[model samples]
Target chain A: MAKITGQVQMLFDLNKCLGCQTCTSACKTAWTDKDQGQEYMYWNNVETVPGRGYPKGWQTMGGGFKACTNQVDLSAPLPSINRDYGAPWEYNYDEVLTTEGGDATVGMLVPAPRPDAPNDYSSNWDEDVGAGAHPDAYYFYLPRICNHCSKPACVAACPRKAVYKREEDGIVLIDQDRCRGYRYCIKGCPYKKIYWNPIVKKSQKCIFCYPRLENEDPENPLAKNFCVTQCVGRIRWVAYAEDTTSNLYKLVNVWRVGLRLHPEFGTEPNTFYIPPLSPRVTNGTAPRIPTDLLAEMFGDNCSQTFEQRKARVEEVFAILEQERAKVAAGGTSELVDILTSYSESDRIQL
Target chain B: MPLWPKDTLTTGRSPRVLFVWGANYLNQAKGFLDVYQTLWPKLDLIVDLNFRMDTTALYADVVLPATSWFEMWNLNTTDLHSYIIPFTPVIPPQFGSRSDWQIWQGLADALANTGVVFQDSLPDGTTITRDYATLGTDFRTLNTDGQDLSDDKDACQFLLDSSVETNGLTMDGIAEQPARLLETSEEWTSDLLPNQAYYGFQRMTEHLKPLHTLTGRQQFYIDHDWYLSDFREELPVYKPPVDADLYPLRWITPHGRWSIHSTYRDLKFQLRMQRGRPIVYLSPSEAQARGLLDNDPVEVLNDHGSLVAHLCVSPRLPAGMALMYHGWESYMLKNNLDDTSGFKNGWQGPCTIRIKPTQLVGGYAQLKFRLNYWGPTGNQKDTRVQVVKYAGTLP
Candidate 1:
């Protein structure tokens, strides 16, 4: 048994995932298409994971300098972190030009860094786009989003206390009313998920369909997370991974069902994944000899798994045999069924 | 006006004229100096390059504080993309920044004092790119000229208003028809083309016909059949320098929202975003071997010079490679701090050193002091080794 912290998490098997981007499109159709929600980003993105980050290089852009938790300055890796502070800037490129020879070159213009790096760096920064390309170059799309961390750095980093981790589901949320756009939370989050709505100057993030959760009670067919509901690969599992003995917990924590991008930072992130690491199984049109270790971690049915895995280019079709069986069986003897049964009764705070 | 001797060029057998350069790539754009020095026989040429100096304009014995983009209004017509984009700013620049046009205007005046006057007018022309003569019905009332390169603020306003065009779109009324054309083989408006593009940098034109304005008429030919090269036959011709140590690290700092390289380094908000020093990006596999962490302060030294930066450890880089971002400076108007106190932490500005424009430093700005995230580049990365032999199947 575990404490009902009201913290819930979702996990996806990256090994089983195909990067169809259905999840992204689904969210766009459900939320971002709306006026107020246009700028509000969501709970997930399918990054290349190892190489190119989603929505460009969100990582190298740097947000906060999370101070180490240890009293002494650490040469070795430490557990927690502190936010790094730096100045922000705005620009206008047309402030210094006059027309000549029917051509007007820009003046006083310092534009922001462009989308791609110099030397024509692509999202797949490593792969060459033109001439003598690698024949067997491989990359698997890794969908990523806010991890709904157990000890969210964003909540602790907000000096104004504008952010709160819901006691019910443990979901991190921003109080738009109280937020003054200090961006401390933005700095504190190692993930850099939190963003300032340039229009309203408040903080916002994925609500996990809170309105739908309360109204339709989650059990209702209409209730769905725009990102999770639309995954074609069916790899997205929107479960309350609280119970320890269940397969969900085992897969996420022990078998490490999902791996973290990095753990040394120690944000206690909730998102977990079965990585799309294709280190082995190199060469040949098809891998005749499956990497034994990879097959074992995933299962003996490597043929079926790889066959289905290969079809993961479009994420809208995720319902493989394993997932179909789980959904059809109608609630396993897992902790989730027990917890949700009591969900209505307790005034739970995450 | 600053005073100087008229015989400054003939003071010695040959006087060294240090030419300050930004990223012009064109060595002959300033060939006028070579012509002048040959006639006068008094100039010894030495070109000093400041890779990304937005603050100072280095000319042939001429010094100008180039006005930044925010300091001037701009109108531009892309000969390649074929459309005019008007760039306007919300706020005036903070201090001594001046536009390139103004600097050239001054150079023209200076040359005039040397008993030379350049013609201030050029021949009129038209491009078959859009058949500019037949662009609109009345030229004033009808506006759809079929182009996608305009960044006019009125474009956003047009999206909101109810103006109709000959094609029944408001954008056309403002002479801003999108350049999207049907593909040669596929259904014209398919997602195939859209898939190749990024968020804002979408290509509007489908068929890249050789623009006619510069040539006086539209020239149609297969993609391969064009006599297109200023210095060579290739479009992006890579001309390696004869002197290897002259320039290395084909540095490229694409755009970001914080602002272009040197434009925003002065303001309090943006100053925090820039790197205090020029940061050279290295792959993680390269760093691990050299004993550097993702944020560990390390020096990226080449034969030309060295730049210090926090390591950005990511798997994206294959190996035997590094990168650096360009543009940032104090502009001399902002509060200046001595670099002695904050050496390890790094200083924020346009270059590695805060020397006056007259004296150049071999570096770029930091943008900001923030932690950049990269994926676990490899199980064990070795960044320093020059030869990046992939150690085979690393995590």
Candidate 2:
């Protein structure tokens, strides 16, 4: 293992995330557009929660550790290219377009399934299709990327030692040269962030825009990740986890508002999210998003029972409501100040 | 074309030329079937200028390639925003394409070479003269400022110098950062602050300025003869949709999340996030009742026309509504081996163009012909359709 120098963390404020896919588009344009197998890969994707996420039911697909144990769940399944993550289909533009004096027989321009990835399901196939029916239906955008965990399962599962967390920034990167595309990392990763690049015969994941952080371009030196900087909602904050003065640290440690996703997975993801607050019903009887659902996602069950986890979620929601009420009433709140500030200094401090 | 009807009433002449620019009117226009069948044959020429091979270009007599956003020098401003953003070319136009300004300049030059003068006798017995020989020269405006306005950058600068809101601003200044408009225009009903949020009708409400109306107090009641006739719609009233008897479900076409109209709709990355094609959303119960499961091909139709697309059974939507996000090109919804819903060519097959008679009234205050503001908006929301499970054979 390399010397522990630093670990950067990200804080995503779910309140503001609109799931516009601007960040996803920016990351795709910056990194993965040209590569053949990377066509289906969205290093940063926004999925509508309370829905089957990218790769279908990734939450229940199984991976990481079992409960409080460090043992990797041997029953972890690999996501299918066609069934889970839909193939990068091509449009029949040539046949349908009128550039060549038109083809009257051909119908509208539609997706022609790629033979390599003939797929029916897409990365966001269940978009906006939240779990309940009609008025009770609820959904929120969850923009995800490689968590860059302190103990990444991709690093542990790789027999070739190709996948490693950087000592400097804690960015988990797959060594393309060493990667043989065994795909164990894909099975081991609980978040399903790791993707198999069939053309390159290597495993790939989000690099956290390490080159931008390295200040490679003298003309436009960007210290923050492309996704964080290009985020239209300004929902993301990136900073060193050890920097107590940073909002990422304050939100996760001091304020206790940001919680890691599936903490019981035991990878200790560096990514922390400010859980989405559900609207109280018309009569203020129950939450639009059930507490049990929120708990199922963000609750840390390794340290407590499911009931306790649900209580914790409720407690956090209450705290958020209280702080919001205080701010709405023309009062002051440090948490609100931290979240509301549009300054890049407050959000992305390297 | 409908609003600015040339030689219609006074001249008693029909329009012979059509220039469809940027917009995909054939694909997006409501009651496009009427335009194609009734209006199209009467036109002598139809020219389309666009960066993409949009549906309008498919039917055009001549298709002129226009430079894209990244390949053009232009100024961007909208009624919704307070700032004027400048678009400086990142790269030169490729594949013999030219900017819109240059394309029109070329057309002027071509017309000048023909030496044909466009002369029209007015109703007052005076002749309206447009000498084609001097058109190329006049188009560049070299006589006034000795600057060839045919050049896109020069044209952009001339626009900046001409507009009172952008008079002092330069292309370079806006390129660095967007320049705020010096004053608000009538089109924008709000006063623009430096960085504050815009609240419409602030001048009328806060400063007591009279609005552009007869009574000037946000009056919706229009007691015009047209409004009082058979409709009696002087005040707002919910009239049942005209197509209610034709179909069972309302087709609500909302703006798409993946693409802005048809812009990036064909991109592989954008399509990968979606179901790889255009899809229609229905309530779970509705889908089940129609025997349509997720990813099942379905045909949505009415008296207007029909369209074929895969169904997405979603609980998020309400019953009695079939929601299809807008901007899917006609070329994308064909009846092929994969789709046999019997629709010939997507939404391009045609739909309703139900224009309210009250909207045609013009003599009243604030009801005059204002481009996009006060006009006969084609009531597309009232369009009704029946969703049925497509019994098409799968590959």
> How much of the real interface does each model capture, measured as fnat?
0.04, 0.77
RMSD to native for every prediction?
17.7, 2.9
In lDDT terms, how accurate is model 1? 0.41
State the fnat of model 2. Answer: 0.77
Q: Please state the interface RMSD for every predicted structure, separated by commas.
A: 13.1, 3.3
Which candidate leads the pack in TM-score?
2
What lDDT tens digits, residue by residue, belong to model 2 across residues B1-395? 14334456787677788899878877787775567667788899889998987767777788899988899899888777677888889999999999888999999899999998788776666789978898899899854576678778878888988877788888888888777888776656777776786667877877888888889888888777777777888888888777453687878888888888777766767777778777889999999888888887887877667777788888888899989888777666645322354444446343577777777778578788877878788877777788887666432
| Model 2, residue pairs in steric clash | A108-B331, A108-B332, A108-B334, A109-B331, A109-B332
- Candidate 1 TM-score to native: 0.34
Give a tens-digit lDDT track for model 1, residues A1-350: 12336666666666557665567556655654455523324345454533435323555443323342412111222111111111112244334222244332223323233211231122222211111112333445666667677656677767788788777777777888899987767656656566555567676666666665656654444345667666666666565666665444655554433544443344666766554434333354343223332332232111234333333321211223344456568845332232223322211111
Chain B superposition TM-score per model: 0.37, 0.90
The positional error of residue A306 in candidate 1, measured at the CA in angstroms, is 14
Q: Against the unseen true structure, what C-alpha lDDT does each candidate score?
A: 0.41, 0.79
* Model 1 chain A poorest 10 in a row by lDDT: A78-87
